[model samples]
Target: MNDLTINTAIQTALPATFLGRHLIDGNWVEGAETFQRVSPSHDTVVSVSAKGDAAVTADAIAAARKAFDAGVWSRISAKERSAVLLKVADLIEANVERIAVQETLESGKPISQALGEVAGAADLWRYAASLARTSHGDSHNSLGADMLGVVVKDPIGVVSIITPWNFPFWILSQKLPFALAAGCTVVVKPSEMTPSSTVMMGELLIEAGLPAGVCNIVLGHGEPVGSVMSTHADVDMVTFTGSTAVGKMITEASAGTLKKVALELGGKNPQVIMPDADLENAADAATFGIYFNVGQCCNSSSRIIVHESIAEGFVARVVALSRKVKFGDPMDPDTQVGAIVTAEHQTKIDGYVKEAVAAGAKLELGGGALSVEGLGPQFYQPTVISNVTPDMPIAREEVFGPVLTVLTFKTLEEAIALTNDSEYGLSAGIWSNDIHTCLEYARHAKAGTVWTNTWMDGYPELAFGGVKQSGQGREIGRYGYDEFLEVKSLVMRVGRDSRKPWVKASA
Candidate 1:
């Protein structure tokens, strides 16, 4: 086996002069001002780029609007559109390794995890291509014999796509390709923290034959650029994936123009483990649930609700498994996990741990940042807390860290009630051998997705979104395509040869 140091691999694998510019209208340019792209693990200057502003954002949106209105790309048939998307997918697959390395370097996720995300991104683009052919219209029966009606799905025009930092490429792929496949032009605003891969995607799309102004990227913070995109009059829809607070702001801003807003926001998802589940497997799954990507995932199983009968065993197993997780340089193949995104985020997560500890919850395994033997800045230990109650702030809030909280429930009803208590319901899981119990929980859990025997498993073929505060609209599957399109009802008079209705009424 190749035993390569993460830092060494990173230094050798990635060139220092990698591109760090915004992609707008199938071309790259420096913004008005500049911002540094710092390495999350070592706190070093990875690169710097011109800071994009509202003007750049507005320019990108205008370009997208022109593309949609001018029918430069939107007027293509579904088959032709699918071919373009398929070509993009092929390009992504061919460059998965480079993209994966970029993702790991910027986002501080394990290299293996980044690779998975890259492959998943390819799958997502391919899935969207498949869906292009399936965007169908429905025929409806009318009241009169001569009257016929149909509902055709049409593109929702220019889309303002603002994606989060954690899974930059993967998340943007989830939103953008489907929008394009639905015949919409897009203006993308990837998070400044991890904008490299997203900008790379723009170049790849251009290489894959995407026309100018069809897909544009403006990299910057959310305050001005994102705000302008959300509030832009020409933008027909806004799709944002980020904090719940910001999502609310986007919704409010979009409301000013009555633009359709699709949000994929925060989650405090619960994982209920019944007495009959395999404790070892469930514990391992739960460990990966929160520890993956250092728990930056919106759907990470943060809440663990175990049956009273096996809570003790599950907690012990989870603690042992958490200890076994090898936290080292992300580039090392042996490293199961890597650093958190930034020092500020590490401090924020540590604060959450401290609060949970102060609130009388037992910090079973880890509860603090780790200055690991060879790592720097953005590293933290995997955390596990037990004996947590529903009322604690840590239990209810979205921590967005590698932290897991465990609680016990005596009955199935209690488990269901506790799981449904959160305002966020992005996704949840139920682990049980009893089919009836699993089925019941799946039916009652107030999340967008419910897992019966597994946790944190997802596919490009399935639709994913949340209800309530977790955000609106779906991504990934056929339902994801529907989010970017609006249904237009068409009516025709097929058999109205005589005007008998008025005559009969007069008689």
Candidate 2:
């Protein structure tokens, strides 16, 4: 692209605005308070949004409940629903550059990754549109001459979605499209830090012809807005993506109403490097696994469990890769690593590093805090720590930053034990040349997802989620739609006569 094109692409066509207010009943209304979105790279206020509290969040829940139960949006055919979603996808694609820039400025992610996420999110919408028609229920053959049995899936009505700041558009796309495809009305509570894109998404959905209230955006903190949405009596389901602590809170809040809850929480995933693995490939994979998106990913491989034979070599290679990573100017396409989300989060990450060091963990590469040259107070620089024990805070805690801890094991059993030591069971990666070892780890690893010979990869077709503390329920596949749906089993009497008398219960 030319210089003019490059400059123009990075700038948003839409004028910068406060974007304050929650989108309820098809219009924006200010809440009692407001929250500021600060640029993590430069520590400057980027935008602000109305801090939706319990009352305002209740309004959104009521609107979604009304849309699902009374409005025409949920009454449409699957094909018609798919058409609307496809339109939303198209509109997002048309404004990809603008949305990408907005996301980068707010979330402190690299502009290239942000653009890719925007495109990927748009594709997710289109994919869900196609899946709408494909995911109908199934019928079973009657066991006897007089009976017919079928299993049907139905939308669970109003859904409350609470998303995180990292990959703002992508996380929403993951939940919202599937919920829409399932014929459910949605109320989204985006992270206070990156609420701008979601608010803009409201306008795009409107332009895409989605009926008002079919999809709504509420901006605010988790305590009030998120808690209210999770506990709202009218909301039939709640889905959240964030830390384990917050995920637990959502589950607790939703318990009173018995809302269906789907959580994608934190992870302390392990990257196992076997003795026979390609050192170069493993090193590169390990680096990208932890450092990509500044290690803010739930499935990031923060723990490197390597065989003792190759520990030093692998650590050296990882340290080399860490040093070479470009960390600055999130808007630059060449920037391989970007800033952490905020100063508070950066401090938290640095604390983890310090605590780990105090606990006898060796800082192999970048450790401590770093401020980008041009940027004011960004958390840049890739970090890699070796000689780390499982007991170290950095090894166990989800720092949610670009910090990696390396540990060594002599035997496969030890490695497996170490990998399963964490409370999280989100995802793990095993790098090995041996087919048996790959299959063994894949079979025995205590994680929701496992990658053999690869790391930190995902697709729309594959399901994503966790098993233990990483959270419950799945997203991004058929399970994603299933999470938003309630299933009913239909059973009919096989014989008209009194041959088989059975007591039946009503659902």
Candidate 3:
């Protein structure tokens, strides 16, 4: 039996079902159909959201297109756009408690984690505000004695932004604010499971004084909502954060129009440990890495490639830490871990653990579901699998749970090989006391971000994305802000007679 405290006391009063509507052209509109949201943890209704169809998506696309073409938002001054962004950031801070409560209830994550994600998202908006003012293009004055060349950066018109349920508010901030910073109007589709936070963001956006039709929220599934958003001719680009399979579908959907696509998808990230490293700190980090957000994050270090000399001790340390992590009511402030998002997801996680054990891997810890005293049985225990080979699915696939797999490596070369063996190339962590080891991994690891002596520490200034099948394009920093923009070159002559023409009049 797990010794972690299962807090049975409920402090916060659950609110009545929230009404989720579509935000189109500065108006809150109702859909033809509405779907109810049942909290996975409490097994209670949390929201009733408008169900969007293809027609609704088309309307949203039209609104964004019209808004962009009319220059209602796209043609605004950078200072004006930046000021609105700052206000949005301020409003986010003001509404953190309200948003966090709903996020925890709908998403089945701990209130603490939800609070952190929502609070931290404001920084992204603030940083994007700064980016709007500093963004610029290039010019060439020495093209010729009487000629000049200039390049201008402009918004890429309408964008379709689709976010996943795991990190709804935080992920939306990553894409939406950057697009706004580039002066691009957008239509966003949040995962049906967690639509309230995005709707909440729409409320914040409007209160920040964003112009009509600048940002629209459409609630529904991927089919009619996200599908239309991806394939519509009026949408100039699609920015998505979800599974790699859906990302692939978006890539194919946008192919006809050749619209720009930016995706942050799945990851089977690994963290490498050296014998000379600080083993205690590394073990603690590994424990936190796999369990944070219940390991549902794309950046989670699901597997750890450890040097053979210290493998056994490191595994034991992590297992002990896992045993002590609190897993219970999400509303409790002291709970370290919370419920899984859904029963289906919990079953998938258990299947991976069972398959790994059947494939000759040793189960050092949990491998099944847990029923908290006051909640439904949607919680998966912190699991650890050892004696895992690089070829095993448990070691290679993106399990996306609070489960950690251990693969042993005898040398630095072997560790690096094991890290790069997977199809994913998103993020990697290296824990080593030797400068040479960390630097070598930094140079060789085929991931977008490399964390040396740390894991998953991100900054708004640093770009985030992946290589190979993980995804295309970055999500934050200067590069992320630039992704929503288009560049054009202009050549000018000082006088009418100064320009040379290649075409002859006789022709």
Candidate 4:
């Protein structure tokens, strides 16, 4: 179907009844309390979602634990698990339009972007399903004729998955599918700001024939639910994607039980453009990297460190492109830049811009909140601040909005230095024609993933994660499956006589 038809169908068939409940133990359970979900695109109530507290969180954890220990899912063969995951991927693709609509309404991302996210999520699930069958361990052939050593990867057990509001379904797909592929039962806590899509996925899991308690969805604030998920002894692992501050808190909570923790945290990613770079392509990529998803992505290239020779021209091109971005209703397929996820986030974005301008950074483009006649007040204009230094808070901190800061460097060494100076090492990009320069930066950049002449490129086959304070552990590809698995070595002796005489020699 065409885009317009799909959008119209979604609006007409809004699934409001799907809200206000938690999926636990293969049942839709009501929460003790409910919270109204306000759409940032229109400032209207989209739906009411269950606000899971400690009791509800505990129930979900118990369910996951039971599922895992009972071997209802954990004992399934790799082929069986792969089939289920493939079915889930198919279900996601079938409901792409509806998923995209719900995601856009909840997260205030443009409908087009939401569609792309849904597609990416489906791809991730399929990739994970393939990995489920191919994930294999090693055999030690050099153990000699009398001994055999075999290493096998087994499911870690119940996993607690915490996802962020921005790219909600996409991030959940990244973690949940891989964990399930590895035979791990999961208790998912989607960001309360955007929980409807995940709750709907609970239904999809049921339809996909996932066993009871194999996956549970709990929606609520971070305090009680998240605390329980991270600290609960039944949870074998916690996979989180959000702010670094919250990631640290989860890490501390998980320390009590010593549960495995996989975090994909925040980033103030840098995009370096050398003198020989294609100015137009670099500007385009930089603009998309920062403004896409309203710059809420952890790997958003917010920092553009250009060589002095081409700094002014590149900044001018980016500013011109930024001004052209359409800021309007997220539901509109044509919208390029949508609303911030919340009013508070809009304020935060504006505050960062104001602080930067006050601190002497020149505002070359938008620097304030945008108010469309029919849309809500959550929209923030695509902003560009020039002449920023590395020491400035705007340059160092993650704004999590459609805000870009421009800085200049004289040498390649200085560019690498500026990129690695931040505590975060999530992702970065380099725009240069010279292969040597690209290779040098790719090797030295502290970020987990670096793109040459491109920005924000990702694939399911690639391993994505951060380094340093950006967080630990990897997600996607075989490594993502490894996160949910525990390796055990089995050693056996065949055709050997047992003898123990070391202690008897003295006697």
- Best-matching candidate per lDDT: 3
Q: What TM-scores do the predictions have?
A: 0.95, 0.93, 0.98, 0.96
Predicted candidate 4 versus true structure: per-residue lDDT over 286-386, tens digit per residue = 99999899899998999999999888888889987776666677777778778788888888888989998898999988787776766677877778899
Worst 10 residues of 4 by lDDT: 1-10
What lDDT is obtained when candidate 2 is compared to the true structure? 0.83
Q: Supply the global lDDT for candidate 1.
A: 0.86
Lowest lDDT 10-residue stretch of candidate 1: 1-10
Which RMSD values do the candidates have, in order?
A: 3.2, 4.7, 1.5, 3.7
Ranking by TM-score: 3, 4, 1, 2
Candidate 3 lDDT over 2-24, as tens digits, reads 56445553756997789999999
Clashing residue pairs found in predicted model 1:
33-51, 146-495
For model 3, the stretches where C-alpha displacement exceeds 4 angstroms are: 4-11, 496-507
TM-score of 2: 0.93
**Which candidate, 2 or 4, would have the higher lDDT against the true structure?**
4
Query: Would you list the C-alpha lDDT of every candidate in the order shown?
Result: 0.86, 0.83, 0.91, 0.88
Better model by lDDT, 1 or 4?
4
Model 2 ranges off by over 4 Å: 1-18, 492-507
Question: Which residues of candidate 1, in runs, are more than 4 Å off?
Answer: 1-14, 141-143, 500-507
> What's the alpha carbon RMSD for model 3?
1.5
Q: Which digits, one per residue and each the tens of the lDDT, describe model 2 over residues 134-210?
A: 98787878466776788988888999989999978999999999999999999998888888889888988888888
